[model samples]
Target: MASAFQAKGLQYWVSELAQAVLPILPGSAVEIRRLLEHPDTSLNQIGDLVAQDPVLRLHVLRACNNQFAEKAAGTLSNPHHCVSMLGMDNISALVDSLKPDCGANNRFEPRYLQAIIQSSHAAELALSWLPFRHQGNADQLVLACLLYGVPDWAMWRVASNEARMIDALVQQQRVPVEEAELAVLGCQRAELAKALAQHWHFSDQVCGAIHGAPIPSPAFLMRYARLAQKHSNDAASVRMPNKTEAGLLAHSQGFTVHLSNTLAQQSARSWYSKPTLRCQAIVAAYLDQPLVRILELTKSVALETSRRFAIVGVQSPAEGLLWPQPSAQRRRIKPSQMDAAVTKMASMLGQGSVPAKAPKSATPAPPSQRPDPLNQPRAIGIKSEKLPDGLDHHAIRSAPKPAAKPAAVFPGFVSAEKYADYETLINKLLHQPSAFSSEQEALRSITDCLYRCTELERVVVAVLNPERSKLEAYYAQGCSEAPALQRFTVQLQPPNLFTQLLRQPAATWISRERQQQIEGVIPGQFRQASQCEDFFLMSVFNQQGAYGLFYADRGLTDRIGLSEAEYKIFKSTGAHCSKYLMALQP
Candidate 1:
């Protein structure tokens, strides 16, 4: 009887701790759960629902990856892939797993509920306007917007005291949330959220969006726009915008002003019916603002929004979007000290412990003492002083060179005849100037054709930025469902893989052996961002310097080899594109 009582007590304690740390799914997510319960629901339909809620999306992705990591051969990056991999049955099971008690009956503070509602509103705004501007998947925009303020929700759940303090600082001290978080906790909320997201194995694009990095993708831009609009405030400290103000601001930002205003009013009406002070404040503020003042606010708001979320700029620590490591101050606790452990965990969540500094050594090492053999120069083209007894030195010195090895062929490529037919189709498209209306259309069509003809898992077309310093992907196929491809970018600095490839006129296949040699030049974060293991890069150019490049890969597949014929065909496609580009020049 005593032992059973102790076990029951321990279970209760654990349940409390879980409630403190685990996030509650918002209303939209609960609705999605209901939809998932139905037998007729499709994976795409569930994916669409999951994409609109960040907390649900994160949970779904984590569950799917954890359950099917071996079968998928890799961690799934997008919700669509997760749904497709897990199927409707597994997805329903996942929803069941997350169906905890979350509603008005739960003891949640009004402020916490308000923040979630605001986040949902931001998602709704993105869903309404972002699809009109961007290509690729609309679901991406929804996910990005929903997750833009996830750090706040995370903090609210795990460390309510710190969350309250940050709110106090923002409201009373009139400081920005980021600044207040840094001043009080010595770490930014976004950084903490990014660390948690990484722990949950979120894609680099999601992490980057949370970190407010310049991703240049449409979803990233829409996320920034929604966040900027959500966080925009007036001199009077109003958190929500007036309907007229929202409409004008939306118009300035190239959205449909009337639709935006209608949505704003609808959200406002819903909030007004709620019994929250924050909701009342929004309605009151909207009533007080004049049209002239609202119009005046639009100019500064637009300028500030642009500056806060610029598409192109130098990368900073905030923009670096790296996964943070745990602080050295965090220590393991014994199981016996359950109460103390729980308290410590809560404190750690609320106030991130500062990392301890390393003690300095007695003295620094001299340059000569730190010699590296890999950096040392080696003698080349020098004849040896002695030869083996059986060796003929004259024959060895004057031996004819062996023939060059042929390029490797990719596995599962079509036969030579079929490949010829594919090439014929591509060449015909390239030669026909009237087939495409413009240079971009022609380039995009070629990439699409290559993706279809080659039957590769992924293909992308990246062009040099106007500065000729960075390569940014503008067109991609096969992997449009993946977020990484949509936001792929590479710098062309020296000693980098991209620079090495750009210097050569021919296409180069990145085998595993070669990938290791250039690992130093290619950062691990870049690899994570692209989420591709093996690929071939072919530069496209014509007389004027190299303008763009084609990247193809069988991403996340077991097939890892590229054949000589495949390489030739890949290079031939680029050559055809080059010829078409040359013909377009005046």
Candidate 2:
């Protein structure tokens, strides 16, 4: 099946590989397995343990949900309920299943081994350091760190050659790992990992960690752990760049960095069971040692770990590890040598240095005969003739002036009197007994008011289903008889902007600038069907939670700009609708 998918291409094979390896636990999962061995462990205790790690919780819930689909009344909200439903025997079996077969050593490749080692080191660091700063379960942090490199392992399993090529490109070009992966595989590894997590029903927090944008706490810890591991294992000094490279440097100075480094130092100290030369070297690197010294220290630490661990029936720490090294044959190809070779090549080709700057002439030639300045090659180190004193040369040959920007024509703002009138109208609508008779009627009245008062080309009201898991279009106005709004039924799960808005009830003005920023969060189908550039998202809620949302938008070419007054009015309208909705409820 894996080979068949691989033949189809990266998209198919990567997903298949992710699914194949979903149940394969990292080396750190051994610790969790050890805890599950005791018979006295309660469901709550096991739940807590599983919940700490997103992957573990996901595995448990997925198994439980699949096994009890018909019997279960609702979706299992947490690990405790899932474990309770599955029972200890089933839970034990699930844990045992996650353990890699001891007999299957031949299946583990060098890349897989390396990823395991990296994950173990990161998990150790997280377990050691994450607890001191926060009261949350430390085990979850450990699990998150352990699974941080899952994408790398999955990629290697599916496309080893492509994975190696990506690594090489990242090193050679000094580009980001994700960017290099995108160049080679046509998709970011992190995005693939997130997709897999989502597919397997991982918790939102865990999925977000895999995504790594807007870095959540767990993801942040994993990043630091990876950085420390890289520094310790690599022979070359991991030089911290002077300036923060956008999208590259995850941490500058914060609690997360400080805690990660502290944990890293602690993990290093535990390596030898006593404070030794290697331990000091690791600590010094964490303390921000000079780059040259860090290189030396890291090499010593790697050598020590390899020598000590290899003696204890463990694999050599640095065995088969690829580390960037300083070139030893420094004088083999100098800049001078390259220049000399280039000069000899040019001489042999009978080409002289750039034709002697167009021979200077006393008088200017006719425009037609003279070379076009735009077309002519610019001469190096040659200065143009100076203009006569006070004769502005820049102004004489300046480029054409840019066109003026058109004034905003959209009716987004309202005068003080007009705003007062809008407020009065909203109040009147809210107090009207006939309007509040039914939820549908209230929604219709609200949509009608927006259509009449605002410059919106379309307006829609989508009501949450009874399960609160899906939203369906209940009302729409303007644009056409068969409104495009009907196509936008949104699922509350696998959260998008609509779901997020429901979670935090608010009125959002989706300006053109913001629309681009949040394109990923907005439903692609809705974006395509509506073909609207900017829109207003107003979430309606009662004490029970967000029951519906009102969407208003202009056409694709037009912009929707709302002032503070207009925005407040939109909010009040939504609020009034919410009040009427609650009143209609039994």
TM-scores for all predictions: 0.33, 0.33
Summed over model 2, clashes come to 1
Query: Per-residue lDDT for 373-478 in model 2, tens only?
Result: 7887654222555445675666656746678987544344334444455556567455433213234445766787776666555788887877889878876777
Q: Backbone clashes per model, in order?
A: 8, 1
Evaluated against the true structure, the overall lDDT of model 1 is 0.53
Q: lDDT values of the candidates?
A: 0.53, 0.53
- Residues 245-321, model 1: lDDT tens digits: 22332112212222222233233222222212222233223323332343344323333333432322211112211
RMSD of 2: 30.2
Can you tell me which runs of candidate 2 are displaced by over 4 Å? 1-14, 22-85, 92-108, 131-140, 168-176, 215-586
Q: After superposition, how far is residue 561 of candidate 2 from its true place, in Å?
A: 90
TM-score of 2: 0.33
Clashing pairs in 2: 52-140
